[model samples]
Target: MRALTAAAIGLAAALALVLAMTAVGAPSGETSPEPLLTTVPKHP
Candidate 1:
């Protein structure tokens, strides 16, 4: 039971670390402005 508890805690810590890293390393929406500007039609 103790081992299982430790394993679960470790897994949770690892998942949190991965999520934090991804959130930090991911690109911001402002990085790409062309797509947002060009997606709409120029003419009616």
Candidate 2:
């Protein structure tokens, strides 16, 4: 029981740390560039 409780706490702490770091970090909401689905032939 003790081990399980400790493991849960550790997991929660790691998650919280990641959340906190992201909260104060750079904006990660930048839109991804549209995928180039097709390639065009190059002219010589």
Candidate 3:
């Protein structure tokens, strides 16, 4: 039972770290453009 609890805690910590990194790398409510999707077949 103790082992299971420790594993759960570790998993939660890892998940939190990943989420924090993602949030910092790409902030919320921000729009990112895709040049490849935008260009092509334009004024052709």
Give per-residue lDDT, candidate 3, residue 10. Answer: 100
lDDT of each: 0.86, 0.91, 0.85
Clashes of each: 0, 0, 0
Alpha-carbon TM-score of each model against the true structure: 0.56, 0.56, 0.57
Residue-level error in angstroms, candidate 3, position 29 = 21
**Model 3 worst lDDT window (10 residues):** 30-39
TM-score, candidate 2, is: 0.56
Q: Once superposed on the true structure, which residue ranges of model 1 sit more than 4 Å away at CA?
A: 26-44
Clashing pairs in 2: none
C-alpha-based local distance difference test score of model 2: 0.91
Residue 40 of model 2, lDDT score: 89
Q: What is the C-alpha RMSD of each candidate to the true structure, in Å?
A: 6.7, 5.7, 6.5
Q: Candidate 3 residues 22-43, lDDT tens each?
A: 8889655856685456656668
